[model samples]
Target: MKKQFFCAAAAALAMISAAPAQAQPQTQDDPYQWLENIEGEKALDWVRAQNARSQEALEADPRFAPMYEEALSVLTSKARLALGSIHNGYVYNFWQDDEHVRGVWRRASVESYRAGAPEWETLVDVDALAEEEDRNWVWGGVDCLSPDYTHCMVELSDGGSDAAFWREFDSSDKAFVEGGFYIPEGKSSVAWLGPDTLLVGADTGEGSLTTSGYPRTVRRLARDAALDEAPVLYEGEETDVAVAAAVEQDNGGAHVFVVRSPSFFESEYYYARSEDDALGDLEKLPLPMNADFEGVLGGRAIFLLREEWTYDGETYESGAVIAYGLAGAEAQTVMTPAANQSVEDVEIGKSGLVISYLEDVSGKAARFTPRKKGGWKRKEIGLPDNGVIEIISAGGGTDDAMLSFESLTRPEALYYAPARGKLKKIAETPAFYDATGVVVEQRFATSADGTKVPYFIMGLDSVLKQGNAPTVQYGYGGFLIPILPVYYEDPARPQHGALAGLMWVKRGGVLVLSNIRGGGEYGPKWHQAALKENRQRAFDDFIAISEDLIETGVTSPEKLGAIGRSNGGLLMGAMLTQRPDLYAAIDCGVPLFDMKRYNKLLAGASWMGEYGDPDIPEEWAYISKYSPYQNLKAGEPYPKVLFYTSTKDDRVHPGHARKAAAKMDGLGYDFFYYENIEGGHGGTANQDQLAYRTALEYAYFARMLMPRSE
Candidate 1:
């Protein structure tokens, strides 16, 4: 569904696509097909060779070492905000730094955390565990049992991959339970249903994985039983994306459910109950497939409507928040987003529901409580406007919630939105770079289809006025993710604004964050508009912004550098083959270039809902037009792109970048390629790795886009 995949017949587009794939060990018309052999010694040799060359090219630059150090300092800074999740009376936080590279599960009392001086207590040291076990263990997540908040399930992945193993841990003793609840690695989802019971979805060899490489069935595991002997709660088709059991707890009771997802945006919910160490038949919830189950509060099943639905003579529009009685009664409306607004996040609390939204790209939040008579009561939570609002924690056994606000020029600040009274400022992240004289401006660009695309430009006033200033355009147009103007979100990716501001803007460079289609900037409609065949609209939107910057004299083609990773990496590929003349440099990371073979790769088939099945001829026609690898030309003065991927990346297969680089080399094009031997889909596992990658990225831009020193 996101960061997107499909399989198909070999057609004329196949011929065009196969041309570049032809390299040394060409198999079945794909020359670089051997690259897909992930851990194969031969494939790794090529990756190592590329990494060496790229490291030599970037690390030798004078700006690289200093940029690396600065990034590491900010990443490991103690001044950064410690975001916490409320559970019982504790505020828990997961922290990773220079010392705890693998991170630590720690917590502090709610009182201490709110006082702005937290007394930390480490429950589990992941770094120490990894050292003791002699394994590359990454902290996946830890979910403690409700009510007591003592017994917990800890998930740990290898090299930060999606597949992870689960282990039972005792928080009070600060140690894992000896030989307690252990589920081996797979694309698994497991949770605590009770103190001695667990609801699980994982692999046990044959038929455990769906076509999408996820759990095809949900099972209930006892504390003493082997996973294979666990009772099957529900089973879904192999074609389905996944089937997993979910547990929603509140003041009323725990609401257990089995959600079967046929596609990314569609889910079928079945309510379940357990008694005497056994499960009762699941009762399918009478709700539209498109309705997303938000959470349960006050014995009501809350939902976010993605499409219109009429229940019991009452009609609710799409994007409306509604709730139905778990004991069976008429559904009631919660809140509806306006034409210009899009619901960004919804969190259920002990006292009310907290909804954060974007109105014309401005962030706001409101708390809602259902009335006993009919409708609902709404109270807007007072917070700074015109910035990014993230609901960090809401309904984890407490009415008090944790939230953060930030903007392009503003450092992120954490706040405690208590059950009553004003929002209290807990802490603020120190400025990563000098923001003095920096200006953040939003401008609209006209796309080819007459649609207005929004984008934010941040830079020093002098740089904004300077003609043909060195500029970097960053974007990710797929996935319903709205790329807010923040310092950074995922610390794993370099495209986020933090490193760009620290390494680029201060050196007289301009940075642009474009809000293009195929994203949830304006909600689901914005994303649907650019799905499948309409995918070109997303590319056009990004291009329009690039053109606007050039036409407005903020930057020219020679001084422009573009960066995007994952889905945005696909966008970079489009920019590469579609309009290479528009930029001077491209940093393409872990991208999907070979669209024809994408679905056959890991987890790619699951995204057929977003990107149509390429196996079908009609779908291939539109896709072949913009498929980046197939679109590459012999000579177009294309920018020297730096292609980077990770050998341990299990989500977006490393083959995508590997095959593309091999093709580029065969075409006699100038480029840089780097493949990290470790790391997962994020391309980096820890702050140290992220800092190094960040340095390599900014250094590449400096060499390609920056002007010569006097």
Candidate 2:
């Protein structure tokens, strides 16, 4: 069995509460008509008292002392993010090539900054723009853009169906090529060979199945003398396993390099020039260890090899990134965060590396550039005094690009800068809601374990903190994604603002965000405190926070409510089963309930690296102990919870949520369930649909947590 070795007594006691009594309801004059009911007041009082009890537990628990230290780090180090480009200059400005917001392409230029030098700009947003007719059948769009940006290659569906067609986008003429080649879709992608010629790697039915599933073939495309020319670069070794193809150079004419990795431990690269077939040297990135190679990124192929043995006697943080350089070279460790710290996003350019990582130091974000020799140019991008800095995109020249910026009181803004200097504002989105009257404060509460948890107190602060205000709290405790303030303030636009629950807030409800563990709040160490077998620690911490809030007289569980999505949904599920007496209502959306089979589902397997593979006996033993679906017993009273999932969710199988509801219903549990039939991962497809979904959530929260008859 693996353990973190370092243990604090306070942390352990905070993991379970010995006292959890419902608090007395606090009365208020003119406490919004919507929250005038006894049910609302009771719920509010319940959570408030729970929160207080949790605080007392922390004071008495020495094992949980570490949690408070970590929470303080998170609160003090939240980075204030800024946006910029750092590669070539012309492409740094944000541009939209696709009409669909998600599909829109941004091209910003990056240029080097010298003393008294003129700034340079380059083409960045060279992307496929979808015409009205382009969105007809397939979920496809433009392929590659010509070197001079005069011609664009479009990948259309076969017969306007699921199959794809390859056509050229000639900007000079503003029309597609007269005729096009049929490029079958698989793990295939297109690379430009010339202004008019393309290198497309595709697989047909016999080669790669055109249907919506997995396993496909690989090939390269080129221009043919006749309109109907077959594209056959090379046939890959036949196997059921779908290997990912990596393209090294994006803009080049001398030679094109293609790297193929069947697994993280092994890889093969083939290089060719001008449609000529002379496969170059095959490079293998071998790690003398048992590791799972994810996929390829940048010009190098990536692998996450788990060291079977612990490093310095610690098994919690043991994965490393091995980057295999093309052209038969040694695999270099391009980047590595603190042990156990999860890497969020990595942007590598000619300059170095800008990695967006979960807490590694002080629980805030840090930027590091690889020194030309052997080490790294690391610095804390000091946005912490205001808020957390999230690096959206970086690359244009050697030291610049546009970055998306935001803070507690600021909406997202695009900051234009040349390098490690001053940032000038370029653009910002219009706020659909007014937050002029709302105030958001960052506060830390000591948990039962003495671990401090950071939470955002948002609402009308003029009201006393001890008032019986209706409150809605949100939290997510899975994966390492952080919850930073969105600088979201809009009172008028209830649907778009934090006031999504404003129906309750407008009715005097306070909205709160708990930065629970199992998140990258205070770096990797903070998250490791509540992982796998220790997963219950996250739940304990959350319950403790709720207890503290109630004890502080913010709102009791009766008028208090909880909401979470995805893993947060799983958090809610756990809360409902483990401590249903503490919460009045819970909104669990797209959650994984069946812990026994979570790994068998779509996208669930990938999470095994994070959540641990339940199939494994050692890991399963711990997972089973807290598995929500298995732990739900018959005849136990549960909270009024609403479970939501999407039928079209291609990721975590909707079955987890669907079956949980069915089982709960059959077992006679009281809950609400709604499953959308469209929209893949998200329960809803578009913005309009999102508004409706949010409206329903607010309505449900208002009805249960802010009843109108106290």
Candidate 3:
């Protein structure tokens, strides 16, 4: 799996505690409240029963086995490109396959990696480590020291949970350092201050964490000192979400900084006075509370604004990139997007900054150089049009960087761009499935409020022309996360839509990706438009897209299906209760069903900034309008939805899905439910498990939406 944020572990801590006082009133009224006891005996029994029923029904289908095999082949194919980040003089990657179930940390020289035939040298084999330690060890990631990049800290999770243990490792010897810096299992953040020192934020003892269960104190620890003996560097309020410390290194210089997140969307930043300055006496950086500190580039601190800011009598709009000198507070605008564009990401190079932005939801990138006189200059990087471009690796003590590009019909291709040269293709992934006759088109649907929502449709021209083809529309319209088009190869990423093409579109089904409101497609304003009371706008936008598809003759009510997970799973729930007559099947994965009690669940309290607090009567008044569990009415023509969640999902509680299914059962509605014993919020632990779960989803859609000939 990719590196998950330490805040995930902090969120998981809520699972062990009782629900907040705000939920006490509803607890008595809920008959299924006992199901919230995640690992209780009775709860496991109920989960097992539902899992068996779901597996027996879906796996028994004639199409399940073949689809599973096809998915497995694509997942474990050796022809897939092994992408990695450039560090020191080598490219580092963590790889897993059928043979190595747990994966391995390996490295190769930049020349060899760029040559397309990397000669990999294994640093740590997780499967072997798991066997030796007698634990189900899952690879988290490694944070290496800059410059030489010899000493590092490796993270390991148990059973794919968010909580993990950290240990010091020696890259030169390819082994765990004996009697070196180590942090016991917890949701912790650690960064190297020096070879023998680290800035840490972890569970020190009682009262060390915030109300949201994240570390509220940052400490400076010496290599030879015990964790409890470490000196406190900085401390935040108990109401804060989290406090983290980091050391940013680049060609310009190295700087130490601390961040205090009071909520999911707001933060306060502090910087050390000098390299050798005391951490406890840091100076605060004067910047907007709703801005993200990107990094230090060329002696300037880069920031991406989430809200409009007025600094030095100059206004910087939201979604703009601005920079200030590390030694001074004067800010200058680096880049700003057009009305239809949003800056997606920013990365520091050796001497310049590389930015990835979206124009009308299409990906574009450029390099910004600081002019000798004053302002900055921009040079557009040439890339394939109508596709998503991502910065794979950058700012690893070099001016050269690597990027990847892909689209619905186009396979992924990696490119290497040097400081002074053009982009050269270094590697390309072979198409997993044939797309000779595939047609990709962008369309717009007028939403309930007359807003134009853009979406992508992929299918065979002949099949779409015939009309009424089995189709599945997917969306996630929250957290400012923009859904883009790409051919997915990594099971760990999960955001790619290529798997749909192989498993559904190649089999004569249509695929639709919705770019609705509450996304970063057009910038922060797009997301703010759907916050709190206006959250229904996102649901309305999705429903409008589905209706437009039917009206265009791409699919009918009986031939249409919908899929979403996590926040998107909440979208699935809204669709189920509000527009049951429009969809034939619903795949709701790890969803939040009972909105009234969502804030009491794991990590749900942290998202009150996005979804209003139900405890407040004023907010609940609007939330109650579309709370799926509260709105499900009897005698309604609802589709048979398949609900899947993980028992180890420390983020979203499994009870959300379980109670939803149980209520449907009580209402005489039939639905499918599956709960994996492992896997965190992702719902799968490894490639095989991912393939099996994916196959089950496709099979369920086939049974519900595809026509049968007897």
Point to the candidate with the largest TM-score.
3
How close is every model to the real structure, measured as TM-score?
0.95, 0.65, 0.96
**1-710: candidate 3 lDDT, tens digit per residue:** 01122122223222213333214443666787777777879988999999999899999888889889878877877777788888888989888878877899999999998888889999999999999999988877788888778999998878776667889999999999999989887777788887888988888888787776668888889989999789888899998777888788756345888888787778888987435534436878888888888888877889989899988899999989999787778899999888899998898887898899999888898999899998999998898899988888887888788888888888889988888887889998898888888898999999999999999999988899998999999888887877788786446333355677788888889989899998888999998889889999999999999999999999999999999888888899999999999999999998888899887776677677788889999999999998898998799989999999988776777889988998899899999999988887778777888889989999999889884461
Residue 610 lDDT in candidate 2: 46
Better of 2 and 3 by lDDT: 3
Q: How much is 141 displaced in model 2, in angstroms? A: 8.2
For candidate 1, lDDT tens digit of each residue in 1-710? 11112111000000011112222244476778888888888988998888888899889989899989988987877777888788888889999888888798899998999999999999989899899999899887777787678989888877876666788999888889998998876667776788888988888667766777778878888889989888788899988887777777666466788888788667888986544444567889878887778878887888888778888887888878888787775688898898878888889888689999998788999999887777789999888987888898897777888889988778889989998888988898888888898888889999999999999999999879766898899988876767778775556655455666788888888989989998888887888889999999999999999999999999999999999887788899999999898999999998988888777776667777777888899998988888887888687888889999887767777899998899998889978998887776778777798889988998899899874471
**Cα lDDT computed for each candidate against the true fold:** 0.81, 0.50, 0.83
Model 2 lDDT tens row, 133-178: 4542223355434224555555433211122445565544656556
Clashing residue pairs for model 3: none
Q: How do all the candidates rank in terms of lDDT, highest first?
A: 3, 1, 2
Q: Least lDDT summed over 10 consecutive residues: which range in candidate 2? A: 9-18
